[model samples]
Target chain A: MRVLGIDPGLTRCGVGVVEGSIGRPLSLVDVGVVRTSTELHVAHRLRELEVGLEEWLDRTRPDAVAVERVFSRSAVSTVMGTAQASGVAMLVAARRGLPVALHTPSEVKAAVTGNGRADKAQVGAMVARLLRLDAVPKPADAADSLALAICHVWRGGASDRIAAALEKQVAARTRGVRP
Target chain B: MRVLGIDPGLTRCGVGVVEGSIGRPLSLVDVGVVRTSTELHVAHRLRELEVGLEEWLDRTRPDAVAVERVFSRSAVSTVMGTAQASGVAMLVAARRGLPVALHTPSEVKAAVTGNGRADKAQVGAMVARLLRLDAVPKPADAADSLALAICHVWRGGASDRIAAALEKQVAARTRGVRP
Candidate 1:
C-alpha cells in the first residue's frame, strides 16, 4: 500500500510518501516540506498553507495518510502554529477521501525501532536502514515523517493477527467475568 | 483599549471581548463558545470554526486579539486538534487586520487573581466580581477566555509604563557601561 506521512508544523511541514508492506523496506515516492513564512501576516500564512497543501496533495496521491498528533508542553505560541499546520494536513487528507491515521511520537518510534522511548536519532537511523537508503533523511522532521509512514505500513501487515489477539483477550476477560 | 480573549478548542471555542483601561473593566461585550461535534468530519468542523469565529469578530470588533496558548503533557492527537482551532482564531484576527497578543496561563491568572498559580475557580470568582456577572461564565472555557481578556485589559494599562521603564533601564545600563 502507498502511504503518506506528515510532520505538521506552522512554518515547516515535513511530508513523506512511500510504497511498501509491513516490516519491509519502503520505496520512496516523494519527500519534502510545506513551508510558510513568519514574515507574512497570519491570514497570509493560512492562505499559503492552503495553497501549498493543495499542490502537494495533487502531486502525491497516496492511498492513506498518517499524521503526527500534537502533545504540547510549553510555548503556547508555538503550539498554536503547529496546530494550524496540522489542521491543514487533516483537512487535506479528509477532503480527499483518504483514511488518515494519527500516531504519537512514541508509537511511531516503537513501530520502527521496537522501542517506544527511542529518540529521534535512533528512529532516523532505523528508518534509513529499513528503507535501505545510503544515508539517513536530513532535518529530523523529514525522517520523522518517513518513520510515521513506515510504521503505518509495518503495522498494516499484522492487522489480522493483532485483531485476533485483541479478540481473544476480550473473550478471556468475558469468560473470567461471567464465571 | 479593547482586548478580546479566546480559548480555542476543537469542539468549542470560548471568546470574550472587553474594553477597559489598566486595572478596571470598562465594558463587556459578550462571552460565549462556538461548539462543534468531535464525530463530525474534518471539513464540517472547519466550516463551523470559520462561521463561528467570523461571527465573533463581527460582533466584537475589538482593538486587539488575545489567545491562550496550547500546551500538551500527553496525547498528540489532542494537541493537533487544539492547534487547529487556535489557528482558526489567529487566521480570523489576521484577516481582520488586528494584532494578536498571547498570554500564558500563569500570566492571565497573575493579572486577575494576584497569584500566578491560582486555579480556574479562583480566577472565575474574581472575573465574576470584576465583570459584575450574576454567575460565573458557564463552561470553564468561557470563564478562562473572559479572564484572559480581563488580564490584557488590566495589565495593558501598564504597557506604556513598562515600556518606558525598560527604556530607562537600557539607557542607564548603556551609560554605566560606557563610563
Candidate 2:
C-alpha cells in the first residue's frame, strides 16, 4: 500500500509519500514543502496554499492521506491560519476520494521516535534512519513530513506487511478447503 | 460595502451576507447554508466546503469576509474538523484577495446582542431586527454566520473603503501642514 502524510502549519506544510509491498518495510517515495508568503494578505496566502496543495495531490495521488492534527495555540491568528491550512489539505485528499487519518503531534512523534517526548531533531534522525534515507530530511518541515509518513506506515502495518500476509493466508486457507 | 460571515463546521456551517454603507447600519444581503455528509471522510467534507464557499464567493463577491475564530474544543475530532472547515473559508477569500477577519463566538454574540452572554436564540432575534428581516436565520448556523459578520463590521470597520478614506485624510493633512 502507498501512503501520504502531511504536517500542516500556517505558513508551511510538509508532505511525504511512501510505498511498500508485503513482507518488506515501507520506503520513502518523495517529500516536499508547501510554503506561503506572510507579506501578502491573509486570504491570498491561503489561496497560494490551496493551489500548491492541489498541485501536489495531482502529482502524488496516494491511496491514503494522514495529517497531523490541530493543536491548541495561544494566539488566535496563528491558530486560525493553521486550521485553514489543514482544511485545504483535507479538501484536496477528499476530492481525490482518498481515505484520511489525523494523528496528533505527540502521536506522530511517539511513532517515529519511540518516545513521545522526542524533540524535532531527534524525530528527524529517527525518521531518516527508519526510512533508510541517504541523509536526514532538511529543514524541520521535510523531516516532520517524513515522520508523519512513518507514523502512517506503522499504523497501517507497513513494517510487518500485515495486509499482504493476511491476503496470502486467506488464499492458502481457501485452497486447502477446496482440496 | 457588502460583507459575508462564515462559521465553518463538519456537519453544519452558518453563512450570512450583509450589505452596508458608511454611517448606516448593515442590512441583510442574503442568508443561507451549506452542509456535508457525516459519513464522508473528513478530507472529503473539506472539499465539499471548499466548493460551497467558492460558489458563495462567486455569487456574492463580498467586499470582505468574516469568520468565527475557532475556539479550543475538548473533543479532538471536532476541533480538527472545525479547523479544516475554517481553513476552506479563509482560502476562498484569500484566493480572491479579499480581506478576511476573524471573531470569537462570544464577540459575535455580544456585537449582535448587547451582551456577550447571549445565546443563539437571542442573537438570532437581534439579527432579525437589526437587518429588519422578516424572520430569523434558520438552523443555528445561518444565525451564527450573521452574528460573525456583524462582529466584523463593528470591529473591522468597512476596511476596504475605510482604508482609502484614512489614506486620503493623511495625504491632505500632511500636504497642508507641510505648506
Q: Model 2: clashing residue pairs?
A: A43-B94, A44-B94, A84-B87, A87-B84, B14-B141
Query: Scoring model 1 with DockQ, what do you get?
Result: 0.16
lDDT of 2 by residue, B90-164 (tens): 766655556777788878887778798998789989989988888888978998898888777777765555533
Q: Which stretches of model 2 miss by more than 4 angstroms?
A: A71-80, A106-122, A157-179, B73-77, B114-117, B153-158, B161-179
lDDT of 1: 0.72
The residue pairs found clashing in candidate 1 are A22-A154, A69-B76, A70-B76, A72-B72, A73-B72, A83-B83
Give residue A141's error in model 2 in angstroms.
2.7
Fnat of each prediction, in sequence: 0.33, 0.59
| Candidate 1 structure quality by residue, lDDT tens digits, A1-179 | 88888998867888888899754557988777777767654444654665666676778878777888765665455665776777767655654445667788888999989999998889999988887788888788888999988888876544434433433433332232210
- Candidate 2 structure quality by residue, lDDT tens digits, A41-75: 55556666666776667778777777887766434
Q: In each prediction, how many residue pairs overlap at the backbone (N, C-alpha, C within less than 3 A)?
A: 6, 5
Top candidate (lDDT) = 2
